[model samples]
Target chain A: MRGFLVLRVVAKLLMPFMLLFALYVQFHGDFSPGGGFQAGVIFAATVIFYALIFGLPAARQLVPEALVETMVALGVLVYAGVGVAGLLLGGNYLDYFVLAHSPVHGQERGIFWVEVGVAITVSGVMLKIFYMFAGRQRSAEDE
Target chain B: MAALTLGIALQRNLYAVVVLSGVYSFLMATALVALDAVDVAMTEASVGAGVSTVLLLGALYLCGGEEAKPLTRPWLPLVIALVIAGALVYGTLGLPAFSDPMAPIHTHVVPRYLHDALKETGVPNVVTAVLASYRGYDTLGETTVVFTAGAGVIALLRRIRRRKDGEQEAP
Candidate 1:
């Protein structure tokens, strides 16, 4: 429908701004209703809108299925890797104080990395679910 | 029958029925949000409104569209519903007031999360601090849930290869 087309166009135009806003929310989450999860969901939703309008094949080509799966695993690895790094540094598991000599700064650094992992994993999982459902079709030729 | 049940009974269109079910879920999500359970609200919105409807439509495509006849005898269902309602009401009597400051939950670990999280964890959002750090193990479990769901779907659809082999064997 014409309306759906227009909405898709608007969503396409709005994506970059939405992503920027999501970053803003992520960084300012300490003081706001938005946090890593909400920002990640918003990020995934934007990509989903693209898939919905343009078709799953186009979206998959842009962000491949295999890559998404790898990213999901990678995110968890990165998160737990940080914890292991802490252990090696003579701190408890996930204790970020030893991430650097300055405990507060180290905590900040660790939190930032952890949030990055969350964003990647959450977005990947969300997109993977969308792909599973939206990509199903009667024929591959239709795609 | 209730209006919702009647609506399902009368509706012939699969898409419309799905939309109605989505509407029902949205209503339930709104109720959860009003109850101040933001996590449940988020899960309901994503799983109920977004994913489940899509899955149902996909299954409909595979199985073909046909409405099953409504149950003639509602006695067992009515009994189950009444028992559930009674249990829920009984549980409600033991619950703290919605926003009670004196609630044991508010006085305990929750207060630690709300107050000391920013100072201790250097994270602004207390929920994130709790979910990702203070209780990261639980978050790991949540991530595993997603993994399991993905694997489950793949398992369900992985029969195509076996089916093709069976066809060849038959010929």
Candidate 2:
């Protein structure tokens, strides 16, 4: 793959656009067809493409294992924490009505944050699966 | 799509199977779009075609690319599969017709969601409102499951690295 100049150039050109589309899907989900789940997979796909073109080590270096692990936990915490916030604000568990000054605004704010959390967790899961499979091959070759 | 599935089943090469699976997923996504399930289509395209294909290819690399031969006869499994298919077809006879306005699902809670979703969630997208606010608890549970799966894979794979290092140190 390294010897293929055309492949390298095409990958370099495509990576940024792929990432941008993922972010678009993540943010525009409220108004559009995509949501956290789709956005997260798209995000992971960009990184996987990088791994395919430049090798797994390069992709791992770009997104470290520790960071990916932390993302998995942090996303869940963010989601749970939002529910707790609702409860503390004199609303039912997972209620979005009390998240802001007005009920409608609160619902909007809460849904946005929850979707963000979902996107994070989904991407982390995807990257973790990729890392496990790709790392196994590398380790086997080394042994 | 049926042709692709047949090709996948007939192919002995795991690599071809994985590739055909991706193609099947893409076709399914197109079918979902045709049914006006755009969100589901997007998910299918991404997770099924993108992530699953890469993961399968990686697995093929770690294992062998050729599928193993089955030791037993296939007739019994084929009979069981046909019976299950027949049962499923029989079961569909009891289901409401497609797009039936008076169906149980349409008459149950959908009206409220459709009428009140905008006022309730402040989100124009009813799908997102339903998924994030109406069914927040279920979404939370799904996120937890994803997190747990990731953690489980890390635990399983990282242990091998630790054990290998410990063996080297002991020697």
Q: How well is each residue in A12-66 modelled by candidate 2, as lDDT tens digits?
A: 9999999999999999998999888888889989998998999998999999988
lDDT (CA) for every model shown?
0.71, 0.92
lDDT of 1 by residue, A1-143 (tens): 23687777786798789789778766766555455556666677667667767777778898899987776676677777778888999999888889977886777777767766766676777777667656555343353
Model 1 vs truth, CA RMSD: 3.9
What is the iRMS for every candidate structure?
Answer: 3.0, 0.8
Give the B-chain TM-score of model 2: 0.92
Supply candidate 2's per-residue lDDT for B1.
92
In model 2, which regions exceed 4 Å deviation? B164-171
Interface Cα RMSD of candidate 1: 3.0
lDDT of 1 at B66: 70
Per-candidate TM equals 0.80, 0.95
